[model samples]
Target: MRRVLKITLVSVAGAALALNTAACGGKKSSSGDSGGGDGKKSIKVGLAFDIGGRGDQSFNDSAAAGLDKVKKDLNVTTEEISAKPDEPDADKESRLRLLAGKGYKAIIGVGFAYTNAVVKVAKDFPDTKFLVVDADQCTVSGSNVEGACFSEEQGSYLVGAAAALKSKTGTIGFIGGVNTPLIQKFEAGYVAGAKAAKPGIKVLPAKYLTQPPNFDGFKNPALGNEAAKGQLDAGADVIYHAAGGAGIGVIKTVGGAGKWAIGVDSDQYNQPAVSSVKDHILTSMVKRVDTSVFDFVKAVADGSFQAGVKKYDLSNDGVSYATTGGFVDDVKAKLDQYKADIVSGKIKVPTKPGA
Candidate 1:
């Protein structure tokens, strides 16, 4: 519930008024314009999603949940656009610019991949607020772009501890979508947590599905499966992935191996798409993207939208480890103690791998 200020203004006549507005040139509200027929304020928010958008049952879907919640609770109009594989940076700028040009009050770029696009597009439209979910690249010293960054390493550490405590083989594996600092945070935190739980725990060599300038790693389930199988064959009994949609393949592979798999971004165990193999998912590193998105919308609506970095961490409910299958119940006490240490500054999880 970080910065979540919900203002309830029921749009009883919203449909007809929206129709009339469209009929009358569709001029978007600028600087808090309250031009509705019933004297209520109206605002438009837009979201640009990364690969595996909307129904991947992971990252994109979490952001979609936020958008849906804001539309329902605040009665604001919304728009969403998904990304194409290997789309150029210019294409990202174009998509973001389209939303800005259409008069969206707040436009959010859903992944770190949109850092460049958000940086370039926000400068031209000073009046509109922009948010980048994963990367803080756009929120430089004087930029008017806000960043909704998460302490992923902190959450990853918790799940890593679970994997360590649950490992019967004394070895676990982590699969990342890309070989970038962001994904590396997952590896770093997971490894740190595992070591913290078991001083001699052996983490198999971490693997990435792809490298930079090629983000299909986040979407390609086949590659995830390939990477995971390699780790599992190496005697790793518990596997964790920060590979976005690709993590689905990691989970499936773990299921087939009759081992444990940790999910990311959402409570993946409850996801309908993964129901068939849900039992294999031991836990998920809940990223709270929905909470962040909803908070951003509320900020815009309240006219308190600031351009800077806002971090969601263990202390703020921004990140945590989920226990959907009760597989981690035996280790819950240990994990809780570790979480308490993190929150109380007694433990500082590394953000960069090998740090």
Candidate 2:
């Protein structure tokens, strides 16, 4: 079996780590140290974005939502390093080093592309707290670095069920950015969910790119569009995509064809761009990157940035279902039941593919 280590992107441009200290708003600190407030120390958060940046409408944008929340609630601002997977790792390391040198207390690297970067930087900057999302547990345990991962399978399962129920036709489709474990994280859960909801549901699954890990796949909509069209031509009525930017293309194609689509990460129905497809959206697998990022920032602030692998399961509201489309009411009821089952331990959806 090939172990696919799917690396995600850093984040989008709109994400910042600036703290919103209301009382300290522009008030000069008596201590003469800028950023340090009258009551709290100024905390800087660095966000290293993935290749797709903020517009991917899936993974990267979801992560940005969390960082935005932290900035609004915690009074901590952030800086971003937008790097594609194809970019040299050494260059990214230098960028991380620069942010650390500038006195950022907490640094967040959003995807697997920064897996080695975070590991290396964590070793060098023992003082800076680090957080990595969509990550595999690396060696060199540190109280400073925290891994924020999601039970994508849980959310994927709900949408999978939704896709199964809503597909006017019996066939469904799945398009992903990479062919790695992380992508599999979404794939495994979706297939299982579809099967659980509608036994013997026909599923069409395809990876956008065939390379070892095409992080760019997440940034490409054209490729996703073409792939989705192929599925639709094959009789799939509902398509679910975890392909980040590529997923956007999926939504567009589905909307253009007057078919249905399943969104991921954030609620695609709510996005202005996807407004045209709002009606066609079956449901979305809410991967709560926003909550996870906000909580991680708070952890660093409260001195609770614990090291090691910390998984976000369904029970903790880490992953959930969102369907604002026409079928939301029906989908919501079903999702609620599924949620109950998952919380009550009656359901245990596998996170890996072919499980």
Who wins the lDDT comparison? 1
Candidate 2: which stretches are off by over 4 Å?
1-38, 137-140
Instruction: Compose the digit string of candidate 1's lDDT tens values, residues 1-355.
Output: 1111111121323221111121212332212223446555678888887887777789988887787677666747776667777778877897788789988888988998888789888999988888889875324422568888888999999999999989999999999998988888889999999999998889998999998878888988899999989999999989999998898889888888788889999999998766777888989999999998999889888888777889899999899999778989889999999999999999999988788
Measured with C-alpha atoms, the lDDT of residue 336 in candidate 2 is: 76
- Report, for every candidate in turn, its global Cα lDDT versus the true structure: 0.82, 0.74
Local accuracy of candidate 2 as per-residue lDDT tens digits, 273-302: 778878888778888877767888898888
Q: Which window of 10 residues has the lowest lDDT sum in candidate 2? A: 23-32
True-vs-predicted CA distance for residue 265, candidate 1, Å: 0.8
Q: In the order shown, what is each candidate's alpha-carbon RMSD?
A: 7.1, 7.2
lDDT for model 2 comes to 0.74
Winning model by TM-score: 1
How well does candidate 1 score on lDDT at residue 263?
94
